[model samples]
Target chain A: MTALLERVYAWRWSVLPPITGVAMMAMIVGALVAAPREIIEGEVQRLMYLHVPAAIIMYVAFFFTAFASVMLLWKRDIRWDAAARASAIVGVFLCGIVLVTGAIWGKPIWGVYWSWDARLTSTLILFLIYCAYLLARSVAGPLDEQAARYAAIFAIIGVADIPIIQMSVRWWRTLHPQPIVFRPDPALPNEMLVVLLIGFVAVLSLATWLISLQTDTERAAQRVSALRAEFDHREIA
Target chain B: MNVLGAVVAKDLKLAWRNRSGWLSAAAFSTIAVLTYSFAFDLATGDVRPLLPGVIWTTFLFAGVFAAGQSFQDEVDDGTFDALMFSPVGATSVFAGKLVANLIALLIIEFSQLILATILFDVALLTPELLGIVLIGTIGYVSLTTLLATMGGHVRGRSVLLPVLSLPLLIPLLIGAVRATGASLGLEAGTGPWMLLLMVFAVWATLAAVLLFPTAAEQ
Candidate 1:
C-alpha cells in the first residue's frame, strides 16, 4: 500500500495537458457542426452544447467528494480527504460555469436571467454547499490540519443530501422541469448524439486536468502550512 | 442522575452567564426570520404560505449557532479535561449538552414565531401549523445539537457545524417544508409527512445516542 501510494503522487500532475488539448479541439469542431442554424428558436441551443457537458462534469466532480468522504470514514485516509477537497474546488468552478451558461441559455428561452425551478434551485444550493465546504477548509486557516479532518467528515455527510436535493424538484410541484432521466428516448438522431458524446469527453478531459492540478495544490499547500506552523512554534519557544 | 446533568447544567450556566451566548442565538433567529419575510415579500403576498418554512429554517440555524458552544468554552478554559475525569457517562454529558442547546433553540423558535407573526402580518396562526412546526423543530434540533457536539471538537468549529449539519438536515427540511406547505392549506396528506418526520427523528436520535459518547470523549 505504501509503495503504491508513493507512485500515485509521483504521477498525479504530469499527465493531462495533451489529453485535454485533443479533447478541446474535438469539442470545438463538434460544436460548430451541431450549432443549430435555423429552428423555431435558434443559436440559443448553442449554449446546450456547453451547459449539458458542464453539468455532467460537475457530477463527476461531486463523485470525487463522495469517494473521499467514504474513504476517510473507512480508512482514515487524509489523502482521500485531500482529493475530496481538491475536487470541490474544481466542482465549484464547473458548477459556476454551468449556472452562468444556463443563465445565458435561459435569457433567450425563458426571457429571464434565472428561475426558481428545482434544477436551478438545487444547483445553486449545491454550489453553495460545496462553497461552504471550501469555506470550512479556510476557517482554521493555515496550520490547522483539524479543518481538513472536519471538512472530510463534512464531505462524507454532505453527499448524502444530493439525492434529496435532486429529487426535491419532482417530489414537490416545483417550476423545474421533471427529469428526463427515467424514460430514455429510444434513439437520438445521430447529430445530437454525436455532439453530446464529443462534448462530454471534452468537458471530462478538462475536468481531469483541473482536478489533478487542484489535488496537487492542496497537498502542496498542506505541506507548506505545516512547515509554517513548525517555524512559528520554534519562534514562540 | 450523574455528572452528565452536572455538565449539561454547567454548560448552560456558562452560556447564560456570558449574556452574549444567550443573545447570539436569539439574534440569529430574529435576523433569519426578518430576512425570510423580506425575501418572501418580494414574490408572494401571503406570508402565511411561507411562515412555517421560515420558522423551521430560522430554528435550524439557531440550533447550529448555539450548539457549537457545547464544550467550546470548556475546552478553551481547560475545564473540559476535568469533566472527562468526573463521574459521568459520556452519554449523559452529551444528553445534557444536547438538552441545554435544545432549550436555547426552543426559546429562539418560540420568540421568532411570535415576532414573525407580528412583523410579517401573518394573521392566521393556526394550531395545526404550530403543531407541525413543533414536530419539525424537534427533529431538526436533535440532529443539529448532536452534530454540533461532534464538529465542535474540530478547529474552526463554528464553521464546521453548519457544513456537517446542513446536509444532514435536508430530509428534515423536506419534511418540514412539505409539512409546513401542507399546513398552509396545500394538499399535504398527513400520512406521508408524519412518516417523513418520524424517519428523520428516529435516524437523528439514534446517531445522537451513539455519538454523544464519542463527542464527550473528544
Candidate 2:
C-alpha cells in the first residue's frame, strides 16, 4: 500500500499535467463543437462550460483549504499548513476566474455585467472572503506559526458561509436562474451534459495539479529556510 | 460565567476610561449621516424610502471603527498577550470583548439613528425600529468582533477589519436593511429578515467561540 501510494505521488509530478492538458484541450473543443447551444441563450451559453466548472473548482479548492486547515490545527504539522496555504492561493485565483467568466457570460445574457442577483452576490462575497484569507496570510509573515494557526481557524469559519451562499440563490428572489444541472431531475440535454462533465473533470484535475505544485514549492522553500537557519546557528557556535 | 462577567466588566471599564474610541466612532457616524442627508438633499425629497439603508450603512461603516477599537489598546500595549496567558479561557475573553464591542456599537448606532431621523425629517423612533436595530447590531457586532481580533495584529488593521468583516456581514446587512425597511413601513414583512439575522448571529457567535483560542494564542 505504501509503495503504491509513493508511486502514485511520484507519478503525479510528471504524468498528471500532460493528461490534464489533453483533457482541457478536449473539453474546450468538445464544448465548442459537440455541445448544443441553448435555444434561448445561443452561443453565449457556452460560457457555462468554463464558468460553472471554475465556480465548482473554486469551491473544491476552498474546501481543501478548510480541510487542510483543520488538519493543521489538530496535528500542528507544517505540511498541513503548507497544503492549506497553497490551496487557498489557488482557490483565490480560481475564484477570480469564476467571477470574470461569470461577468462575461452575464453581460450578454442578463443585459448587464453585474447585478445583485443572489448567486452572483454570494459568489462575490465568497471571492471577498478568499481575498481576506489571503490578506490575513500575507500580513502574518510566512514563517509565523501563529499566522498559520489563525488562518486555519479563519478558513474553517469562512467555509460555513458557502452552504448559506448556495441556499441564498433559492431562498431569495433572484434574477439568476436556478440550477439545471444538479437538480432532482436534470434539465440539461445529453450533449451539453457530456461536455460539462468533461469540463468538470478537466478543471478539477488541473486545479489538483496546480495545488500540488504550489504545495511542493512552499514545502521546498521551508526546507531551504530551515537549512539556512541551521547553517547560521552552526557558524555562530 | 464569572470569568465572562469579569472580562466584560474589565472591558467596559477600559472602554469607559478610553471613551474617545467609541466616541470617535459615534462622531464619525453622525458626520456620515449628515453627509448623506445633505448630499442627497433629503429635506426637499421623500427620504422615507432611503432611511433603512442609510441608517444601516452608517452603522456598518461606523461599526468597523468601533470593532477596530475593541482590541486596539490591548494589542498596542501588549495586554493581549497577558490576557491570553491568564487563567481565563478564550471563550471568556471573546465573550467579554463581544459585550464591550456590542455596547460601543449600539451607542454609536443609536446616536446615528437619532441624527438620521433629525437630518432626514423622519420619525424612526419606535419599538419595532429599536428591536430591529438591537437584533441587527448584535448580529453585525458578533461577526466583526471576531474579525477584529484577527485583524488587530495585522498592520493596516483599520482598513483590514472592514475588508475582512464586510463580506461576512452581507447576510446581516441584508437582513438588517430588510427588517429596518419593514419597521419604517417601506416593506411588507420582517419575519424572514429577522430569522436571517438570528441565524447569522448564532453562526457568528459559534465561530468566534470555537476559533478565538486558536486565534488568541498568537
Candidate 3:
C-alpha cells in the first residue's frame, strides 16, 4: 500500500498538469456551449463556473497552509515550514483570483463593482490575512527559524478567524445570495452542474500542481542555503 | 498572578514614564473623529447615526499606534530579550501586556468618545455604551498585543502591525459597531452583538495565551 502510494505521488507531478488542462478546456466548452442560460441572469451567470471554483480552490489552499503550519509547530521541521510557506503563497494568489473574479461577477449583477455584502467582505478579509501571512514570513528574515515559528503561529491564529468571520458575516445579514451551484439541492441545471464539477476538478488539480512546484522550489532554496553555509564553514576551517 | 500583576505594573509604569503611548492614541482618535465630522459635514443630529461607526473606526486606528508603541519600547530598549529570558513564563508576559494595552486603549477610546460628543454633538457617553466599549476594546487589544509581539521585531512594524491584526479584528469591529448601534438606539437588538463581543474577547484571549509562548521563543 505504501509503495503504491509512493508511486502515485511520484507520478503526480507528471500526471496532474495535462489532466488539469484537459478538464479546464472541457469546463469552458461545457459552460459556454453545452449549458443553458439562466432564465434571469443569462450569460453573466456563467462567470460562476470560474468564480465559484476559484473561491473554493482558495479555501483549499489556505486549509493546506493551516495544516502545514500546525505540522511545522508540532514537529519543528524545516520541511513543514517550507510546505506552509509554499501553500500560503499559492493561497494568496488564488485568493486574488477569487476577489477579482467576484468583482467582475458582481458588476453586472449587483449593479456595482463592489458591495459590502457578507461573502465579499469575508473573502476580502481572508485575502488580507493571507497577504499579511506572506508579509510576516518575508519580514521574519530568510532562513531564520524564529521566522518560521512566528509564521506558523500567525497562520494558526489567522485560520481560526475564518469560521468566525463567516458566522459573523452570516448573522450580520443575508444580503449575499445563497449558493446555487454547490448546494445539496443545487439550483443549477444538469449541464451547468456537469460544467461546475469539471471546473472544480480542474481548479483543484491546478492548485495541487502549483503548491507542489512551489514546495519543491522552497526545498531547493533551503538546500542551497545550507550548502553555502557549510562551504563558508569549511573555508574558515 | 503576582508575576502577571508585576508585569502589568511594570508596563503601566513604563507607559507612564513615556506618556506618549496613550496620549498619541488619544490625539489620533480626536483628530480622526473631528476630521470625519468636518469631512462629512455631519450636523449634530446627523452625527447620531454615524457615531458608532466613526467612533469604532477611530479606535481601531488609534489602537494600532498604541499597541505598536507598547512593543517599540521593549524592542528599542532590548528589554524584549530580557523579558523572554526572565523566569516569568510567556503567558504572564502576554497577560501583563494585554492588560496594559487594554487600559491604554480604553483611555484613548473614552477620550475619543468624549471628544466626539463635544465635536459631533452626539450623546454617546452613556453607561451601556461604556460597557460595550469595554468588551470590544478588550478583544481588540488582546489580539493587537499578540500580533504586535509577533511583528514587533520586523521592519516597517507600524504598518506590519495593522496588516497583521486588522483582518483578525473585523469580527470585533462588526460586533462592536452593531452593539454600539443597538446601545445608541439606532438599531433593534443588542443581545447577539454583545454575545459576539464576549465570544471574540474570550477566543482572542485564549488564543494569545496559548500561542504567545511559542511566538515569543527564540
Candidate 4:
C-alpha cells in the first residue's frame, strides 16, 4: 500500500495535467454542443455550465483554506500555512472568474451587468474579503509567524460570516435565480446534468492541480530563504 | 472577573482622558449625516425611507474609527506590550476592549439617532429601534474589535482595519437597515431581521473569545 501510494504521488504531476486537459475539452463540447438549448435563453444559458462549476470551486477552495488555517493555528505547522495561503490565492482567482462570468451572463438576462441582488452581492463581498486576506498577508511581511496567525484568524472569521451573509442578503433581495443543480429533484434535464457533472469534475481537478503547484512553489521559496539565511550566518561566523 | 473589569475601566478611562479619539469619531458621523442630508435634498422629500441606511452607515464608520484608534493607539504607545507582560489573560483583554468599544459605539449611535431625528424629521427613538440599535452595535463593535487587533502593528492598518472588518459586518448592516425600516413603518416583519442581528452578535462575541488569545499573545 505504501509503495502504491508513493508511485501515485510521483505520477500525479505528470498524470493530472493531461487528464485535466482532456476533461476540460470534454466539458466544453458537452456544454456547447451536447446540452439542449433553453427556450427563453439560448446560448447564454450555456454560461451556467461554467459559472456554477467555478462558483463551486471557489467555495471549496476557500473552505480548504479555512480548514488548513485552523490546522496551522492548532499545530503550528508551516506546511499548513503554505497550504492555506495557496488555497486562498486560488480561491480569490476563481472567485474573480465566477464574478466576471456571472456579470456576462447577467447582462443579457437581467439586462444589466450587475445587480444588488443577494447572491451576487454576497459573492462580491466574499471576493473582497479574500482579496483583503491576500493584502493582509503581503502587508505583514514574508512568512512571519504572526502574519500566518493573523491570516488564519481572518480566514476563519470570513468563513463564519458566510452563512449570515447569505441569509441576510437572501432576505435583503431575491432577484437571483434559485439553485437548479443541487436540489433533491434537480431542475435540469438529463443532458444538461451530464454536462454540468463533467464540468464539475474538470473544474475541481484543475483547481486541485493549481493549488498543489502553488503549495509546492511556496514550500520551495521558503526552503531557498532558509538556505540563504544559513549561508549568511555561516559567513558571519 | 476583576481583571476584566480593570481592563474595561482602563480603556474607558483612557478614552475619557483622550477625549479626541471617540470625539472625532462622533464628529465624523455627525458631519457625514449632515452631508447626506444635503446630498439627498432632505427638505424636498420624505427622508424616512433613507434614514435607516444613513443611520447605519454613519454608525459603522464611527465604530470602525473608534475600534481602530483604540487598538492602534495601544500598540503605538507600547502600552499593549506592557499589558501583555502583566498577569492578565487574552480573554479578559479582549472582552474588556469589546465592552469599552460597545459603549463608545452606543454613544455614537444615540447621537446619530438624534441628529437623524432633527435632520430627517423622523422619530427614531422608539423601543424597537432602540433594541435594534443595541444589538446591531454589539455585533459591529465585537467584529471591529477583533479585526482591529489583528490589523494592529501591520502596515497600512488604517486601510486594513475597514477592509478586513466591513465584509464580515454585511449581515449586521442588512439586518439593521431592514429592522430599522420595519420599526419606522417603511417595511414589514422585523422578526427575522432582528433574529439575524442577535445571532450575528453572539457569533462575533464567541469568535472573538476563541481567537483573541492567538492574536494577542506574543
DockQ (C-alpha based) per candidate is 0.31, 0.56, 0.70, 0.73
lDDT of 1 by residue, A1-237 (tens): 989978875764565677678777877777776444537557776666678788878978987887886675567556676688889888899999999998888887788889877788778878877887787767665435445555665564466557655665446446644444225762444675667677888888788778878877777887887788889999999
Q: Could you give candidate 4's per-residue lDDT for residues B1-218 as a string of tens digits?
A: 88899999998987888879888999999998888888888767688888889889888987887787767778878888788777887788888888888888788889888878876678898888999999998888877887777646566788778888888888899999999999999988899999999999999899988998888765
Q: Which window of ten consecutive residues has the lowest lDDT sum in model 4 chain B? A: B147-156
Native-referenced DockQ of model 2: 0.56
Ranking by TM-score: 4, 2, 3, 1
Query: Which one wins by TM-score: 2 or 4?
Result: 4
> Model 2 over residues A68-119: C-alpha lDDT tens digits?
9999988888888888889988888888888888888888888889988888
True contacts kept of each: 0.16, 0.53, 0.79, 0.81
CA shift at A69, candidate 1, in angstroms?
3.3
lDDT ranking, high to low: 4, 3, 2, 1
Give the C-alpha lDDT of model 4. Answer: 0.87
Candidate 2 regions with alpha-carbon error over 4 angstroms: A1-7, A166-172, A227-237, B151-153
The candidates' interface RMSDs, in order, read 4.0, 1.9, 1.3, 1.3
Q: Please provide, for model 3 over B152-196, each residue's C-alpha lDDT reduced to its tens digit, 9 standing for 90 to 100.
A: 556787888888888889999999999999998899989999999
Residue A39 in model 2: lDDT: 92
Candidate 4 residue B127 C-alpha distance from true site, Å: 2.6
Clashing residue pairs in candidate 4, if any?
none
- Candidate 4 lDDT at A165 equals 91
Best by TM-score: 4
